[model samples]
Target: MNSFLLALRASPLRWLLVPLVALDLTLILTRDGYWHGLWGDTGAAGQVPTLFLGVFAAAAAAWTSSLRRPSEVAETLGAMPRPGPQAELPRIAVVLCVFLVPYLVGQAVCFAVTASSWPPGFNQYLGYLLLGVASLLTATGLGWIIGRLLSSRWGAAAGALGWLLIVMAFDNDLSVVNGPARMQPDLLEISLRAAAALLLLVACLWLPYGPRITRVSPLPGLTVVLALVATAAAVGNPVIDERHGSRTKACVKGPTEICLWPEEEKYKPMAQDVLARAENLPPVLAKPDAVHSLGLVYTEDRRWGGDFDMDSGSVWAMADGLTMAISAETFAACREKDFKGFEAQLKADDQSVLALERWLEKRLAGGGEPEYREEGMTESMAKAVETGKEMADRPEAEQKAWATATVRNVLGKYCDR
Candidate 1:
């Protein structure tokens, strides 16, 4: 116990904590207010500090290992009663303490702050947090192993490079956190990655150093390490999980039935408020029918609901999403109509629908005429934009007439058949 205390005094972690905490808090607080009150994102924010700290942890671990080689320590022990892991693992624990303590503190503070506003549940997805922890352990262990192997000052730089390479290798696969999306982490991918990291850390723990640490053959361990690396390559992409939501938790609000997901339940009042203000706008294209949450799909009609995100809490975002949802409904209905083989992509690139969307957005959000960018304007798209601007410039009756007739005709033409 006293040895641990003594080690802490000598460790650079004593000084690193202040800067690390400052950096970590900055990451947590600097972003959009949308995520600050949310549970999952805030918990994920807990892992943000380690992305930078992991490299430092690796380099520092390697540097410290070079300073205290187990063989040299064994020599110093001479004929002492106990020699191996008892003498060594504790110091490694000290190294882990240096890096992990700040991580833990940052996590606790983030959660505490988020918990005040989000009452129903905690961060349901812990895979990202676990991923962060495993990465930290892997970096520290790998760095220590590198220094042990090199037993030189250059070990620190090598350790940093190795850690960076590992991060890049898993770069596409690492889906640590997202803002307000309904999609959660892929547990299968997360487990596979977390497992691979653990196995490697186990290999590091069992690694035999010279003649002092272990008498086991290095060949068997090397083979095992190779196997683990190959398995890591097989883990699936983490961030590629689908955008999903539970209809069971869906809540319908306001006159148009804007359904939102469970996490978005808190915004129901605000959504209703926004819908009320936009009442002067034309009736929704898919009026009287439901406008489900962004991810809730109706397979029978192949209707992928509406545009929704955490940003819907903002007044402008809510108005924009409501108009987008109505426009999407029009798009979905048009897809059901038949088009010629050559016009198949028409369903995707329909200009009339874009115009309708922009026009409705202008009315609901109270914007000026829709700006058509000449840079990439196709002839048909320019005509569609012109129609939308004309609609926006018209009076309420003309706007409604345009919405029901012009959009209907356009949908019936190419956007439809």
Candidate 2:
């Protein structure tokens, strides 16, 4: 313990820890709220902070490990009354603490910032923290191994670059973009990553302390295993169920109750206004049923860029949720035994559904002719629009009945005999 503390005090690498942690915290504080709102998933919100910590932690570990290059002091320590691994354990413990303590502190600050807005369940938040800690531990192990194997001058740089590449691979993978896995946290993926990290750390512990050997070692076997497991976990499961199911939602009451994901609570007023607008549609045009709630999911694009504006995006998302709610109700009332076939028909007639959406949007904008037309107007859409105009020309009583029937028909609930 004395030797470890002495080494820490003497090491120049210790200085890097503070800057790295400060930079990470700065980045997290600046962007977490926007990310949380954009993804609407707390697990996804953890990615940025974790990625930053992992990359720098790996570099710091490598720098620390490289300082121990097979010196007389190392030899003297190894030659002590204790076994080599036991003798070296305290130094490793110190290194791990140096990297981990700052990381955990940064995580706590990030979590506190997130809690002020999203307030995720305790278990879910802890799970995210654990996932991040596991990632940092894996990076530290890999960095230590790399530093021990390579020259001190180049080891830290190599570790940093290698960890960066690994993170980029996960971030920019084509499968992640094309598939359902949009960088959100999944239990299966996190578990596999943690397992791979553990194996790598174990292998690093077994790494020889002296001169490099020509013969193949158990390290190669461990490396191969790690590679295979990480590859299989990343590529094999292109999609896994996200862990957002456990998140608690905050709700508000009005003519229709509006419930939103925790991160989206800041936009509750906007969401409510959208709902109020939706409710304002004439009952004859399509009175929405009792319930209303927003389905929060990760979104790739925003209507605006720069300075984290969520107004347009949140309003549009709320509108989409209202449309889906009405559709769900219509589908539930559907008597068609072949739901698949019914769904297929509904999709085919989506233009009519979209026309209703356009009409609703226009009404929300204060009942004027829509300034722009939706592109690629299908035959069904044109017919629906013409029918809507004809209904508007009819008497109030007849128009109301027709509008209700039209909405029901569009939703595939009331089929003509």
Candidate 3:
């Protein structure tokens, strides 16, 4: 314990520890996903902070490991029977302990803050987090090995920058925690990486000591072979399962239901309100019965199945969902004719429904067309928005009458044909 404290105070790493922790915490909390309340997204986003953490750890380990003394070998032999460094052991321990505290704290904030918001589901990925910690530990081991071999500060600088470039530019599973993760982590793959890191660290422990071999060593060759296997698996094999179909949904149950991804519970009330307004359509026209978010599993039922952008809480996004819901009702109730390859009539029927949806969207905005989100807005949709603006001056009853007549016209033109 005293050796640990002495090494910490004496090492140059002492200057970096405070800054590293401050910067790490800052990065974690300030990321776009911190307030998202997404269990999977938050878990996946953790890699951002871990990137710097690993780089710093590797650089620090190399910086200290390269420092040598003439009596160090003799002192190591006199101090303990252990094969690893005595003073250097304390240095490694102190470096790891300092960086680990901030990493763990940042992770805890992610879970605790997300849990506070009542996310759709809690997918505890302790294994992925473990893989993150192990990544840093492995980098530290490499730094020491690199420093020991090269014995220069340039090696430490290169190791740090090289680690960053590998993580950002390279798409290796061993280094990347899956960019913008789909939320489903392959536990088996995570475990394999962790096991490989542990093996690498074990080898690192043996590198600075042991009797200089008079003959060629087979152990180094064996380690190289195992690393090749890990590499192929990391690159050639898929390490993550699909994010969809992995979790259940949080539904706003009603005759006109709205179901969103479990992580998007915060938007449920707004989704409910959006669907509820659609329920008030004229009795002559079709109304949606159920609406499911885009993130949910796929279904063939047009009336019951669709996805949404409720994750962003944009009102226009809700309008888009409303458009999908009501359009499904329009198709199912009024029906469509094959036209026997008559593309012109088919296209006209589609335009008629789109016009109805656009006008209905204006109604959903409480009788005035506010600036609707233009993201995914189409040429037909823009025309529909203009149609809504043209009709905005008329009474609500006139608008309802037009919507009802349009549906009836579709039913007559297509259903009767």
Candidate number with greatest TM-score? 1
Global CA lDDT of candidate 3, please? Answer: 0.62
Taking the tens digit of each residue's C-alpha lDDT, what string does model 1 give over 1-417? 776777778677678867777777777677555555555566567776677778988888777766644676656655557644445555577767777887777777777776776733254435456656666776787787776666556888988998888777777344254534465555566666666655655555545544222345677468546745744563434533545456465465656776766766666776676566557655437643555556765445565445555532454455567777666565565455353522554645766676786677666545664332346878888787677766776888878877887556665665543
**Each prediction's Cα lDDT score?**
0.63, 0.54, 0.62
lDDT per residue (tens digit) for residues 1-417 in model 3: 998888788777778767877887798766654245666556655555777788887787676666655677647555777544353467678778767777777777767776677554455345456657766766676666556555554768966876666565545454443332234567677666666655665554444432222232477546634653564344344455545643567788765677776666666676667667666678865557666666465676633235555433455666667676776666563443444323543566356666776676665555544544556767766676577556645777897788778778767766544
lDDT of model 3 at position 391: 66
Could you give the candidate ranking by TM-score, starting with the highest?
A: 1, 3, 2
Query: The CA-based lDDT of model 2 is what?
Result: 0.54
Instruction: Say what the RMSD of model 2 is.
Output: 9.1
lDDT of 2 by residue, 1-417 (tens): 687777677666568678767775676666524434333234334444656666776787676666645588657876789765565565566667766776677656656654655533444444455566666766787677777767668878988887888767665321111111112445566566667666566555555564332244676656745754663364344323433221565566665555654544556676566667665444534334333332233323632111112323335445545555555444444436654545565656655545455444443433445444556766887876655444444565674465566576755443333
For model 2, what is the error of residue 143's alpha carbon versus the real structure, in angstroms, after optimal superposition?
Answer: 2.2
Of candidates 2 and 1, the better by lDDT:
1
**TM-scores for every candidate against the unseen true structure:** 0.74, 0.60, 0.70
lDDT of 3 at 398: 93
